[model samples]
Target: MEDIAEAAAYGVAAPSAASSGAVRRPAAAPVAAGAPPGMAAAPAAPAPPMAGGLAAAAPPSAPRTAPPAEAAPVMGGVLQKEALGLVEIVPFRGVRRTMARHMAESVAKQAQVTTMDEADVTIIKRIREKERTVAAERGVRLTYLAFAIKACTAALKRFPRLNAVLKESGEEFVLKRYYNIGIAIDTKSGLVVPNIKAADTKSIFEIAAEIVDLVDRAEQRHLGVDELHGGTFTITNYGAIGGVYATPVINYPEVAILGMGRVRELPVVHEGKVLTRLLLPLSLTFDHQLIDGAEAARFLNLVMSYLEDPDLLLLEGA
Candidate 1:
């Protein structure tokens, strides 16, 4: 029984009472220093007693085998977590690397500034609701992006500087007569922005259909290299992903980029009475070197006015 108890204390299975009482417990092995807690090896057995019951000291020539109380913060500590799992590594591809470098260079070179304002899109939403059947009959989806693109093109026409590009040599600001707006599309391959060529001439329904086609092609990685360039201005709708507002980086060679945030209903004052209004957050980031804050604010105000009353879009002959 005593031998069985001793064996049990040493983590060994105990022998049955009917078995021999001469069972012996093996000496515990020495644990290395720095091992994780609860995983350290057991200490070596104590030296046996000699003639007068004094423990015999180990020989001077014998090497010490006892582990330290704490590990030295080396291999054993690192291996402790290895018992679980490790992170997988992925290599960076050319497209993603080029995007990273371009974005970094844009930030480094451009004199960037961002201005934000919220537009009351209640009227536009109501108009879309009323025209839903007509749009469906025309086989087009009347999205906020279409309205935004329409409004943006009109604002760019009124404020051409916002749609222009600055020369790298600082020779002159080249104002573009053509209006091509780039829509930033997030795809599985990467982010691709394919602009609507001569977007100013397209109607709201036409813009909607084109947007759908461009987004589909971008996601499927079927867009041509030419479609990726020649954008005068860019617009990215972070609203689709529930983003409120973000300072989007300018596509270099283009003077500005606009970000649309998620629309939410909030109480607003109208005619001295509080009313719930659907507000769309707008963030316009531009090159501060070429455009001033006042001009940018005016451009934003124009876009907001057009959005607030979408009828002005047709009235402007846009």
Candidate 2:
């Protein structure tokens, strides 16, 4: 019975000895009834003296390993949304040298001298006098440009081809549909023609406002790309510089350009006697490709009529 008891105890201790490679036995004597068959025995209470030495000799474990690289890349719709929301501004070099050369050549190579015409702007002048005061009260200064733009709009309706451009593709002229009126402004750098789009649709007040805004921006050297392109007709106000008349250059590709000269008091024969009246010099340069002398003369007559009877422009729903 004693030998069997010792054998059973050794069997229960086998797994612990295999796992840890250590042997332990309680100091107390073994019980006769060994642990039941096929049931795990409580581990032997370790021998006390060597237990502390075993725990202290073990090395500290390394940290856990990272996951494998085969996992998918993280993606979302936010990146695509950011790319689509960006705005782009395209900048290009301008043909300013050509424009400058043409302007200088126009002044020097004028075939015909400037023409002078006297317009009785008495009624229009009076209306301006009244409007200027009202405009001043509202912090706006009304200039003759408002009246001129309005008169030009009415005259253009009478002569639509005057607003046309001359395109020479295989010896033919192509007239365009839209009417864009360019106003020539002499900036500190040079001259620039920033046109007003759809001039016929705007009122006199609106045209005046646009001119003022554009001229202000131009002087500041802040004109945008759109302002420097696309013109069908042009007006150069040389009157501000005291020029009586000037054969202004035809802004290229356009059929006609009008020049306004200084308004001065001059002696004119009304009936038989000489009378002092306000007179303005006018010059018109037209492309011979599309406009004939007769047509040009008629267009000038229309413009003169509008200027002479500026009140008619107001009454004509300008």
Candidate 3:
């Protein structure tokens, strides 16, 4: 409270000092013509000199001048339409403004490029179909998001370049050996991405449990500052919001971000036969200055492979 008050007080002028180093008296207002002798206004005395032999100070008040007349409207005297009646301004404050600045900086600083692809998630769908019941038994909801997180972590281990940050000097890449995937959660306050640390070592069930807890707490606004930082990679699933595909902006400092779109059954050609398979749209946006288009495509392929074949994830002991 004191800090806020101090900040507000900053730039405000203090009371003018008098000759005796006391508060200066305000000049009297003008008196009426018929005022009594005692009520007559006296001429203000010249300001006294400083004790250090400086010149006399000037009067605090200056003569007031009339403001300039309003300028005439230009363009052949034509008047502009007033949209102020319909326009409304809602203040963007606190974390919302911070989020906006962060996004703007990310767009301004990185040479972003998005490469999109669709993944055949029939295998992950089948696994989730069986695990949902087991997850319910353990009091956790098994979601495709958990599977996506697992797949992303595995892919990061294989393509570690995507899991690194480029230094400001652009001389070297700071490759992070640890895998921490920030999960973008939509909360009442706004969007917040609190990452899961050491995500590569966690299993599907464990990741699902953490997802449930992190999302619950994130929505409740109980997540600490520590939970919001140190992400090696980020994943934003617009699937829940019914978006098919979007070019998600890369989270700053991190080389890349993977956007997951809504999963639906689509007719795809499978070995000379058209069959309906559950497909998930993936949009991988990366810093072109750090990773090439080919590398981004390969990274997306590895992630898709993990989702397309659940056995690989299990064989890796995830």
Candidate 4:
């Protein structure tokens, strides 16, 4: 009774348990001397020391690894199992398989870093508007992506390091003198990047027409294998799907990848006056092993400059 009174004086839980004819439990362990009333409960008692501290631990369960059954047809890695679920189960192959493998390789091999910025594309927007009808008359659909490609290659020329690929041997970076820019196109089957060879030398209208042809052929899954190779750089415009900004993965073998976001009108201060300017979000993901943060920022700034004053591309892109 006196012990219970002393415990109650400290405002802590009293140590009580079932009396006779009731279930029993271990007594509450002692709180430390000078421990506050609401201090944490005492830790459970340690297990009894193993005999000689050398008792044998049970052997680890057999390691589970991917099956290596290749005695028959169908090369290894594909398991033929019975379907046992309500959800759909399909083989991981085809374009989706290729995409998964490449993406995994890129993430595993390269040190990818994404730098984001907004470009004031107001001037290019106006130019695109004026040329829209003209391009249609010539059987082409001029898009801002064409102008963006022009501007990007112009910037790439100045930053040759970002336009190169590190050799598979990792001994050297192969700087591509000519630009073969890959554009990622989403199709019903999967994503395919068929590059425009010598894209830097082509005019905006040419690029626009090529983009249309590539997209059409890609949708029909008719792009030639050669058309998808030999790219030095890649660009993916998630803007068509309404993305504002994103960290895009590098297209392996190439050192960098750039993503374009939707152009939206926003008010901004330009040359001492406020105006509604068309802004495009740009994401530049580069291999950090080759390009540093400052270099990436400078390269993106140059691209943004061309976007802000698109007339400059005419001088450099040609």
Provide backbone clash counts, one per model. Answer: 2, 0, 0, 0
lDDT of 3 by residue, 45-157 (tens): 66777889886777566554443343333322323325462222234544445566778989988999999999899877787787778989988987788888999888888
- Expressed as tens digits, the lDDT of each residue in 262-315 for candidate 1 is 999999997799999999999999999899999999999999999998889888
Model 2 spans > 4 angstroms off:
1-96, 101-116, 271-274
Angstrom error at residue 32, model 1: 8.6
Instruction: Say which prediction, candidate 3 or candidate 4, comes out ahead on TM-score.
Output: 3
- How would you order the candidates by lDDT, starting with the best? 1, 4, 3, 2
lDDT of 3 at 82: 55
Candidate 4 whole-model C-alpha lDDT, 0 to 1: 0.79
TM-score of 4: 0.72
- TM per prediction: 0.74, 0.63, 0.73, 0.72
Q: Model 4, stretches more than 4 Å misplaced?
A: 1-85
| Candidate 3 ranges beyond 4 A from true positions | 1-84
Candidate 2 all-Cα RMSD: 32.1
Give candidate 1's error at residue 276 in angstroms: 0.7
Please tell me which model should have the higher lDDT, number 1 or number 2: 1
Pairs that collide, model 4: none
Clashing pairs in 1: 33-71, 34-71
